[model samples]
Target: MSVIIRKSLLELIFSGAFMKRWNDKLRPMELVEVDKQGHKMIVAWLLFLLNSKGMDVARKRALGESIIEGGIYDYLYRLIITDIKPPVFYRIKENPDDYRTLSNWVLDQLKPRIMPLGEGFMRGMSEYLMQPEDKGLARRILNAAHLYASYSEFKLLKSINTMDHELTEIEDSFVSRLEALRDLKGVSELLNENDNVLGRFARMCGRLRYQKRWSQTPRVPETSVLGHMFIVASYSWFFSMEVGACRARCQNNFFSGLFHDLPELLTRDIISPVKGASQEIGDLIHEYENIELERVVLTPLRDGGYAEIADRLEYFLGLEVGSEFKATINRDGEVIEASDAKLAGEYNLDTLDPKDGPLLKVSDSIAAYIEAHTALKNGISSDQLHQALYRIQQTYKEKPVIAGVQVSALLADFD
Candidate 1:
């Protein structure tokens, strides 16, 4: 089947309007046998499309000519290139009068391609669509979509291997550690399962990125939720040591950071602007989020051998069951309001005491500042870093723990 498809693909490319029409009417997989098992069908189709018409090639080549002649080819090919390709289709569709059945076809086909690009493209598109005067925004959107599609496919290849093991050696090691942690007395059941622990922790870390206010930072790298978790956990451990805290306290802090934003896996990283609107709007959003968190995040964790762990974590985070421990740690890491803070704070930390909470805070601040300073040394501005350090210092000024720490001096090292 594949051989036949490959042999005919060249003919199809040259078939012009016929091939375009066919692609417009049906999915590429239905028209051709190039869809290889385990290989992405989209990539195969893209290869076919690219071979026939190079990216943004004028629609007047032999293949385009054939598309005009072949009714079936003309139908689907137009649907794909126009609407499904991004920027081009979306731009035209903005004027509803310009939209046709063909336009709808383009949207349906491209959805599969665009969806995999995830939050970055979604955010980027939202911003791009609002730029009313930028005539070039359409082209930029197309470029962005193309780049996103390429990156998504590349990441998919990187994440899994032929051995069929989804987790790498490093990830496997981490899973083993989680399993061991689950076996310990008083360990939560949620962290016991191999998949659940990783999924929940990954989600939590992703959410913490927003809470830590990194999302608003422009040009953040294409980081996965799990990537953020590892960094935060590492920072938590380092700060624990600097404070000469107990090993157990430090371990708890690490875990706290690891699971701080688990609720976000369900709630998503709600951006600042949307969240900061009128009180009534904010309350309505929160209500919707509460229902979603319970239905999605909490329920699944409980059912997946981590119910007890989830319960304990919920208690620790003071969301519901363990609401008693609700607290806020100041910049230097002192618990100021355990109860009210839990209800209002962005990140949940139900079980964490002031010692654990503040240590994580300091670590979070220091890590961010250090990263900023490093970036500045590499030619990025240090204004944000300076502001952050000042804010952190001010927040912790009254605390004896941070007294004489000389954070300004430490930051100067990066400069």
Candidate 2:
């Protein structure tokens, strides 16, 4: 039963024309990239989670300031507009007052394309313990995330001269709208906090554009850490949905995918071969990454009263969680004892493990295969990429199933 659900969601994500736009073109950054919209959508979801944490603060501050009745909506609007492409973006910019018109128009274009998966994910999430209002909010955030994810790569292209002018204008427009809402109490503070956290994350993602993937291969467009994270998260979501993950489990998988490589933000992307050199060296690098993650990301969020956020990050990166191999599924297709079971169960699924930690591992491999396969299709010859594609193919050759879903079939679809 869960496999059927997962299969449908996976198909939906892949078949959506909106998502196809990203698949159709390589990312603008001089290197080949995969699934730009998919990546942005994942980040948008992350931002939504972060925003949810501070919603109480936001509501109190908004009421105190009395700037407008819908300050929170405005704030989200501003964050979302950053992902809108030109023409539509310019149309929105020109009318500003007609934001509703532009927003509606944009939705008209995207809702049919992406909303089914969005709604399905939400329904799957319904098994979690959240207020009805929160579920509604989550739906809205997911919708916005889906739209923004498709366009976010453009923002990263600003560093390249050819794309600088248009990207700058789009960014300027986003900034101007943000500034207009700066006067709302907590708005400025919240934006600053987001900038400190998410902004830094975004910039770190940009640096990945320059980091070459499969460096051993002949020339290939670089797959930055940022783009990789997005693909991982997107792939993870598909797997999670296939497994009939509850809202909390799905959220855990998605976020874990998004931040799995956050340590790379500080250390730069240390290639796998280097880490695989020796267990001692690999352990040392892992230790260093953990230390940096704690010092750079976790501790700061904890001090800022976002201990939950910090904990989530730790869990996603396998910092505090034990080995993922411990995760298992029951004959009934339910998670039995996942590494993150205790935490995942806190939100719901008290008797069943969420298995998100292990699921994320599978998604990570799938994303890697897609990267290599896409590169090969573009005629970039590389022994490493070809090897990677072969290794992944062989590894999952025998219908590798996880949490009751046949992941091999998912991978086979691409082949």
Q: Count the clashes in each prediction.
A: 39, 7
Local accuracy of candidate 2 as per-residue lDDT tens digits, 240-302? 655556654555566677677767767776766788889999889878887887898778767
lDDT of every predicted structure (CA atoms): 0.38, 0.51
Write candidate 1's Cα lDDT for 64-153 as tens digits. Answer: 222211212222244345325434555666775555454445445544434333444333433333342443322222222223222222
TM-scores for every predicted model: 0.39, 0.63
Worst 10 residues of 1 by lDDT: 33-42
Count clashing residue pairs in model 2: 7
TM-score quality measure for candidate 2: 0.63
